[model samples]
Target: MTRIQSHPVLGNTSERLRVPFYFDENLYEGYESETIAAALLANGVRMLRVHEESGTPRGLYCNIGHCMECRVTVNGESSVRACLTTIENNMKIYSGQQLPNPVKRMVEQE
Candidate 1:
């Protein structure tokens, strides 16, 4: 069920070469070099992480990397933004963690 069997606009999907990776603790298959967000979306992943204040669900808003909405931790580091980061074999991604209080304060100051 990891494949988008059907898409409204993309239509009856073709098989994507499976690349192994883990998100949280679940194993997912995606194609190499594809954006992590795109691969996740194709597999019907609607929530990448939750907002800190409201704990509301959020996912890719702008497929492009400009918006931090699709941000997720990769390989123990939060530096790699998912929308811009390409999926690689054996990569680990984490989601739904709050920003550090200091970072949150900095954002509020801006």
Candidate 2:
């Protein structure tokens, strides 16, 4: 794992509850205190989602929940920010995909 072993403020990753979560149907381990983006990045898994319009790859950006770049689906909940959500045992996380353009579709139908 590429996690920070020690930090000036957070200190070290003291013993925390190890939780298992599924991402894109693959199993991965994380800590309960970590957000989805942090856990996935620590596990060496980036590219959280693809651009809905262009299908370009996207990852954690402005992790404070403003840019919406780290969006993911959790336990069937859509558009959940990975940077703000805490990990949970047995949680099902699915990467966001390029969704159809609703506005474009409406114009096409007309």
Q: List, residue by residue over 31-108, the lDDT tens digit for candidate 1.
A: 766788877776778799988666788887887778788878899887567889989898999886655577678899
Best by lDDT: 2
- Candidate lDDT (C-alpha), each: 0.78, 0.91
Candidate 2 per-residue lDDT, tens place, 1-110, comes to 78887788755776567899999999998876899999999999889999989899999989999999999999999999999999999999999999899999999999
Model 1: residue 106 alpha-carbon error in angstroms: 18
Runs in model 1 deviating more than 4 A are 1-16, 99-110
Query: Residue pairs in steric clash, candidate 1?
Result: none
